[model samples]
Target: MTLKICVAQLNYCVGDMPGNAQKIIDAARAAYADGARLLVTPELAICGYAAEDLFLRASFIEACDDAVNRVARELAGLKGLTVIVGTPTHGNTGRGDEAAGGLRTKSMAVQQRHNAARVLREGEVIATYAKRELPNYQVFDERRYFTPGQGICVFEAGEGESAVRVGLLICEDAWFEEPARLTKEAGAELLVVINASPFHVGKGNEREVMMQNRVRATGLPLIYAHLVGGQDEIVFEGRSFALQADATLAGRAPGFKENMFQAQVERAQAAIKIIATTEPERGDDAELWDALVLGVRDYLGKNGFPGAILGLSGGIDSALVLALAVDALGADKVRTVMMPSPYTADISWIDAREMAHRLQVRYDEISIVPEFDAFKASLAGEFKGLPEDTTEENIQARIRGVFLMALSNKFGSIVLTTGNKSEMATGYCTLYGDMAGGFAVIKDLLKT
Candidate 1:
């Protein structure tokens, strides 16, 4: 018998309870229509990942709890379909023991919150799995927010003769062997891992290698459902995939796209095998470009930014940022402003205008020479004959920044800064000048 699993690679907005719940319901409906027995969404799909300080509020957690139940209720009565959603949940182990027909032997203690996965079926939360490993790495601060979970959640999927034991694991849980091995030891023939892992260059390749290692070690077919969106600084590229127990590639969804990918797994001789499916191919540059586009689009769209405004210098960084903004939000929604300083070449304005025209976005010209002169004249009295250096150069950049910010204030447009990694790393960029924007388009990108 074959079991069809749906991996929902979706973009969810942070703190938007109704919208995120509706997204989950819609995805569940589509997956159900496709004959999927189980639908797996990314980690923290309900409330979005890296919620940061919002997790600290009880009201926020309550809203998330209500949203989780709402999704369960909405997805109820769908025959033979189970949806697994990620959320920040209270780790009331005492209540869980009581629900299991045992008296609450433990005393009342401090509140414990967990990064958890909920298994929903028949309009109810059947089982819940808390992430055992709390990653405290570079960008992750899970240790500060959530307490580590203790046990594994292994439940059954499908019914009758086609039923298979499925296990749940959160993002960092799969990195260690204990969680996967524990689930496998508990009779889980299939492992389903949900993740909101942030994207760095070559991260997808690293994920593939990790998945292969886990499959080889556990001898259980695995399904990976990853988030696909940008949340502030991090971008989650959805490369949802499945691997056979023997570590063979099965099916893979494309990166940087919202998809309800279906993986068909069948029971083989003493092991489960994920049937090989079509894997979409994309070049490295294509993948990187898409990541930027998706990141810009999600950051703007989800945050309710009407459009975007950026300083379109003739330099490669600003030009690339303009192209990315146009591609992500469409040309009509993007606006470019050329704030030419006294030092700015005439050819700079020409290039900026030509690129804006080619892209067909709204273009405006604002000369910052007057502002630069004003700033310099005002500060000359205090300078006391000190020779001008980068102070003058920064004044020009700050003038451009002030004009771009003024445009942003006049129109409800997000200011996208065009600072690449190379300039930022060596402190070659201005802080209050070029860096004064709502979003940094390519902060992580190298010059090369």
Candidate 2:
């Protein structure tokens, strides 16, 4: 029996049980319509991953339970389909509570369900796989909430003589070597991994690399399902992929977009079939450009920032910053100023103005020629014995800092530093000169 599985890579809002349940219903219906007999969703797909303090609220927990039960009923009509979804199940109190206040009735609570997988067949839960490994390092606190599950579960899915055995795993379980080993040990022919992995720098490629190692270890066809969108400071890049046992990438979904994939499995050992992954769309500049745009849009929207401003120098770095800022925040919200020096080339001023006009960014020309003369006169006596040095150069930078800070203080706009990685790495940038800003767009960025 050849079984068709659909991996529904979805981005769910935390604490939205009703909305999430609807998504589940929609995805299941869509996948079923597309000839998928089995549908897999990410961890916390029903209630949203990492409900945080909301999990502490009894009302929220009850709402999730309600949603789960409703989903089971919604899925019941499909005779040949099975769904494996990750959710937080509430038991009465402890181990004995399974029979007490309505805890996990089935042997589902692995160690203690900090993480759980509900296996729904024909709309009713037939079995569940609790996550055994709990990550506790950066940004992970699962050890505080869930007890690790110990057992493994593999089920058959397909019609006719094509029944294919499959293993199910939550996000972290696929990363470590043990879980995949155990799943294969349990007689699973294929692997399904549902994840809510957070995004950071270089995370998209990192996930692909990690998945490659897992596929090689298990020697089984694998599917990686992930979430897309932003939650708070973290963003999820959805690059859902299917890989063959030989570590060949078959298909990959585009980054930051929602997609559904169908995987067909057979009884005989054949090379894994990839649904996509042929074309590399984004170029080097384009990827960085998109990343910058995404970072700016998400940062401002998430933190409730109103607008932004930047000092535009004729220098290459400042020009780059000005253009990137305009691209990110739009012309209406971006404002730029060219604080010209006597040494500033005439073409510098012309280029800055043209760029601003082209981008339609708000432009201001604040010349510091007179101000520099006034300062030179004031410090002339104190520097009587000293030769002209960078000390004098720093004074000019400080004066610009004071003015920009004042503008920011008055207008409620954030001052963005125009300095790039090169200047900051060597500390060639003055403290108040180019280093003045509310957020470092490239804090982790290296000059190289």
Candidate 3:
């Protein structure tokens, strides 16, 4: 069987069903007009990915179902196309028609999020598959929302370049081996996945590399459709691609843009073309910078912080933190405070002041020696036998921390901690001193 499939990698709005549905309709129409026999869309293209609490609302899900039904109605007469699109499918028990028994046993009982891909052929629902492997780790809580899908759905389409059987999996399923193994066992000639995988710099190539391994392992051509757009603190860069049964990249769509393209698979090796493709020209370093830029911007913006305040120690960590904050939120939105102690280097002060000025950020300095001396006098009796080791060193830091926190509170700005993993791991940081802040910028990094 020869099949030509189009994956519509679209950008979706979190709560804008009407707007998202229009885009889906337009893309479907365009792909059909371009002679695509199969149309695939990214995960939750209709309802949007990570629609967090929105999924918990029956009205919101009803909107999604209406959108899917509308799209099916709009494309009802497309005689030769099979469209696989992601939508929040509703079920009384959140279970599909297919199951060994009505009982969703032990492990299946944990999380009950119902994420599904609806396959529409000539304007009617053919089959649906619930997502397995609901990621519950950091940033993902599908287990709390969606129940594991009951079974895999494979079907045959005769409208492709040639006819073939294909299997469908949602985002996480393609990452696991059993889903693909079962797909093969079910005699699926092709495997297609819908994902809302976010980009964090070098993540695009990582997805592709994994797909290559998955293709090699399954002996099947793979089609991956990913979401594209900036959502909250995360941006989904849809670098959608396809691999031949042997794991050769057959076609790819661009990132950071709405795109759609088709892959034709035939019993005999189809004449795949190497059309000059222009990707987002993103290098590892550039991607990392972009991700960081987005991360800082979204993290603050979504959390409702008006601006950021940081203690500019003139060290490498502080300098970098200042730059990132200024870049993410405007320079006018960033403020830096330099607290100089007796042990502080002058060059540190000079560098930090200059950088903050260059970035057009408001900068100020507060001397802490007077207060440090007072603290030492007050703690003299408490530290009678204690020979000042790092204790004295930390008092200076604590004073500065207090100064920064005071400035932050007075200005209604958030304190941004500048400690990196190296300092954090070695305990070079003083809690309630350097470690005190509303936001710890580099908290998740490992000590290098």
1-448, model 1: which lDDT tens digit per residue? Answer: 8888888888989998789999999989988888888989899989998899899888888999999999999888898888899999985544445443565645633578889989999798999999999999888999999989998999998877668899899989899999999899998989999998998778887998898899889888888899999988788989888887788788889889888888887876666777646567686788889889988999999889999999988888989999999889999899999888778888898899899989999988887778888888899899877998998999898878888888899999999999999999999999789999999989989898
lDDT of 3 by residue, 183-244 (tens): 87998878888899878657888888888888888888888888877676577877888887
The root-mean-square deviation over C-alpha atoms between each candidate and the true structure, in angstroms, is 3.2, 5.7, 5.8
Off by over 4 Å in 3: 1-41, 44-90, 93-112, 120-126, 135-145, 154-166, 181-190, 197-206, 217-219, 227-238, 251-284, 368-389, 399-413
Q: Go through the candidates in order and give each one's C-alpha lDDT.
A: 0.88, 0.75, 0.78
1 versus 3: better lDDT goes to: 1
What's the C-alpha lDDT at position 411 in model 1?
91
- TM-score winner: 1
lDDT of 2 at 251: 73
Model 2 misses residue 77 by how many Å? Answer: 5.0
Q: What is the lDDT for 158 in model 2?
A: 65
Two-way lDDT contest, 2 vs 3, winner: 3
Once superposed on the true structure, which residue ranges of model 2 sit more than 4 Å away at CA?
11-25, 44-81, 87-113, 120-127, 137-146, 156-163, 198-206, 230-235, 266-286, 302-309, 325-348, 365-439
